[model samples]
Target: RQDPTEEIQNKREEDLNKKKKKSAPKSSYSSVLIDKDQEPTQSVI
Candidate 1:
């Protein structure tokens, strides 16, 4: 049988992993947008 405290800890870790996974794509998407925005300014300089 699993210890209840261990199970809760595992659930918390899973929640953190889920949050990281969700944020990872958002950050990458924003970075891509920033790169696109920078390219035109860099070329103009």
Candidate 2:
């Protein structure tokens, strides 16, 4: 039988890599946005 544990680990790693790639751009965008008008929004939040 195939080893399911290894398969699961591979899938989890793939998912984590995809998440990091997706978040990378979003984090950069937020940093740039806040730098423009962050103090007002930050205090409101």
Provide backbone clash counts, one per model: 0, 0
Per-residue CA lDDT of model 1 for 2-31, tens digit only, reads: 999999999999999788768796664566
Hey, what RMSD does candidate 1 come out at? 9.9
lDDT score for candidate 2 against the true structure: 0.71
Q: lDDT score of model 1? A: 0.72
Name every residue pair that clashes in candidate 1: none
The residue ranges of model 2 lying beyond 4 angstroms of the native Cα positions read 25-45
In the order shown, the candidates' Cα RMSDs to the true structure are 9.9, 9.1
Report the poorest 10 consecutive residues by lDDT, candidate 2: 36-45
Kindly list the per-residue Cα lDDT of model 2 for residues 1-45, writing each as its tens digit: 759998999999999878876879666556666778655343321
lDDT to native, each model: 0.72, 0.71
The window of 10 residues in a row where model 1 has the poorest summed lDDT is 36-45
- Candidate 2 displacement at residue 12 in angstroms: 0.2
TM-score of each: 0.53, 0.49
